[model samples]
Target: MKQKIAVLGPGSWGTALAQVLAENGHTVKLWGHNPAQIDEINTYHTNRHYLPNIKIPTSIKGIKELKEAVIDVDAILFVVPTKAIREVAKEVAISVNTKPYIIHASKGLEQGTHKRISEILSEEIPESKRQEIIVLSGPSHAEEVAVHDITTITAASEKLEAANYVQDLFMNDYFRIYTNTDVIGVETGAALKNIIAIGAGAIAGLGFGDNAKAAIMTRGLAEISRLGVAMGADPLTFIGLSGVGDLIVTGTSVHSRNWRAGNLLGKGKKLDEVLENMGMIVEGVATTKAAMELATSLNVDMPITKTIYNVLYEGKDIHQAAKEIMLRDGKVENEFS
Candidate 1:
């Protein structure tokens, strides 16, 4: 059965997801804040700003107004960056009368507030006007996903039926979706992995070889898992796609913004320099601040996250940060036990 899908963002991930749904024979309306981007998508069948290389399907129409995009849409895919989720959701609440299921593809916790995207949605969208909230996340990068590479992700919701429905909507030969109920773990893993990816990028930027990256990635997962568990997430979920799976991909992939930022930081560039150079959303930079706050509040021992936070915000030296991490008190392999 074909569904009307409203993709509320015209960035690379949004365009890629809209293409996938359009290819699957669904009616997709892509919402963009920028009129120029909308014009390019509608006229040229491509988003020249975010996704320059990929051709968008003609069936995927671009809309500038948020209300027009949500008109009669069966499901809403929130593909905007984490920073914009709340603002968009607030606008959506005004336009949407009927409660539609929301599937979030954004993958960072809100800075200062420390709320996940879903939580923000719940707060902004009135309870009576909201349906089951689903989170879609994994190691899948938008660049690779745009090219139809084999990518697997998890579709999670507290409601099992909702998760399965999301899985059906997105699952394909090249794109696979697994259903899980651990929304907290899934969201936490998605957000925390970006911080780790920055760490991995730093290692690479510092001229360290694969061995150093491998170690950072491994330890990065440890900190991510620890923070997730402390926040009441299932420890096992950290081992799955949203956790270890995402960590492996984002931490290593050159396509990752967080990794790229970390690489620049490791190369002796300042935070402003890294952000200016990337010219895209470096989620880890903001997410690192949120994670550091969350960890401090929860009393979770996340040394790597703390170090990244210090380096990015406090202007701490990366080399000295690395040395400080190395000099920390050693513990057993399993900190949870």
Candidate 2:
């Protein structure tokens, strides 16, 4: 069945998703704050700044106004930055008259509140105006997905019916969606892996080889699972697509903003300078602080996360932080036991 969907945010991920939906035969309303971007998408059928050289389907309509985008949509996909989740949800709540399925593809935790993107959406959007909240996440990147590269991801929700609905909406020849009920595990894994990715990028930036990167990724997954399990997530979910799968892609790819930011940091650039140069949000930088706070409150020993947080926020030297992580007391590999 065809449906009208509102895809909020005109970033690369959002644009790529809109294309997918349009290709799937849905009427897509692609929303953005910038009128110029909206105009470009509407007039040229392209979002050059975000998804350059990619042609947006004519079925997708670009809308600058938030209310205009959500007015009669059957579902809303929040693809904005983590910080913008609440603000956008509130606006959507005010705009909609009927309940719509809420789906978010953004991956990050709120800075001060330490809340996941789905949590922020639930809090800000009135329950009366929302049906089911679904999270679509995994190792999929917008750049690859835009060009129809084979990609797989998890669509997780407490409601299996909702997850299946999202799966049906997105599944295609080159795109695959697996349904899961572990929203906590999926969201936690999606947000925390970026911190580890920053460390991986740092390893590359410092001229370290694959061994160091592999170690960081492995230990990083351990820490992510520890904190996630402590917070009521299923332990096994961390090994799945949203967990280890996401960590591998985000930590190693040049397409990852967090990894790119970490690379600059490792190459002797300051945080502000690195962020300025990238001209995009590096979610791991903020997520590192939130994860560090959450780990301390939960008494979870996340040494790698702690090290990354210190380097990002406390003026600690990256080399010293890396050394500290390397010199931490050795123990049995299976800390989960």
Could you say which candidate leads in lDDT? 2
Candidate 2 residue 148 Cα shift, in angstroms, is 0.3
Model number with the top TM-score: 2
- lDDT per residue as tens, model 1, 130-238: 6899999998888888999999999999999999988888888899999999999999999999999999999898898998888888888889888888888899998
lDDT at 158, model 2: 97
lDDT of each: 0.89, 0.92
lDDT for each residue of candidate 2 in 1-337, tens digit (9 for 90 to 100):
8888999999999999999999999999999999999999989999888887998898799998899999988899999999889888888889987688999999999989999888899888878899899999999889999999999999999999999999999999999999999999999999999999999999998889999999999999999999999989999999999999999999999999888988888999999899888877888988999999999998999988988888988999988887887787778998463
Q: Candidate 2 at 140: error in angstroms? A: 0.9
Which pairs, if any, clash in model 1? none
Model 2 lDDT at residue 241: 98
In angstroms, give how far residue 226 of model 2 lies from its true place. Answer: 0.4
Displacement of residue 190 (Cα, Å) in model 2 is 0.4
